[model samples]
Target: AQTVTQSQPEMSVQEAETVTLSCTYDTSESDYYLFWYKQPPSRQMILVIRQEAYKQQNATENRFSVNFQKAAKSFSLKISDSQLGDAAMYFCAYVGVGQFYFGTGTSLTVIP
Candidate 1:
């Protein structure tokens, strides 16, 4: 069984500032995928970033990026110059073999 852990229950960042959210997972399988999903108050889950276990390069999109440390089983999300619209609940997910796991979730609040 695999489990995703998010130590930070909630995070806050000012507009135009950067914030990093930490995530760690436990898995026995070597082949797997990690993802960061954001859910606004509306309840829609949006894929923010993804990292393949076999890839060395971290994935990045626009102001979103991930720090994937395979050996440490750590995957952190970095939001750059965040906006008020970025406030939402972030989830760290892990998919390995036949199982899928999601963290409890971290709520991010962007203050203007």
Candidate 2:
């Protein structure tokens, strides 16, 4: 069974600073996908970033980036120039079996 684990229960970032959320997983399959989802107070799951297993280089989208270590089964998300809008619950997930398995989730609070 493939499972995602997020060790950090909570994280905080200063507005205009950067924050990194850590995640690791155990999987038997060689090819799979990882994703970061942001759920704000509105309770909508938004895709912050993603990394495909075949890619060696990390993925980046504006202020979001991922440190994907396939060997270690680790995928982390870095949020730069944080804003109050960035405050939300972040989840690391594995996509397979036509669905997603999510981590416990990390609550990020942006201090201004």
Highest lDDT: which candidate?
Answer: 1
Off by over 4 Å in 2: none
lDDT of candidate model 1 versus the reference: 0.96
Looking at model 2, report the run of 10 residues with the lowest lDDT sum: 93-102
Clashing pairs in 1: none
lDDT for position 37 in model 2:
99
lDDT of 1 by residue, 1-112 (tens): 7889999999999999999999999988889999999999999999998999999999999999999999999999999999999999999999987667999999999999
Q: Among all windows of ten consecutive residues in candidate 1, which has the lowest summed lDDT?
A: 92-101
> lDDT of all predictions, in order shown?
0.96, 0.95
TM-score (C-alpha, index-matched) for candidate 1: 0.97
lDDT of 1 at 75: 98
Clash pairs for candidate 2 = none
Q: Model 1, residue 38: what's the lDDT? A: 97
The TM-score values for the models, in the order shown, are 0.97, 0.97
Q: Model 2, range 1-112, lDDT digits (tens) per residue? A: 8889999999998899999999999988877899999999999999999999989999999999999999999999999999999999999999876878999999999999
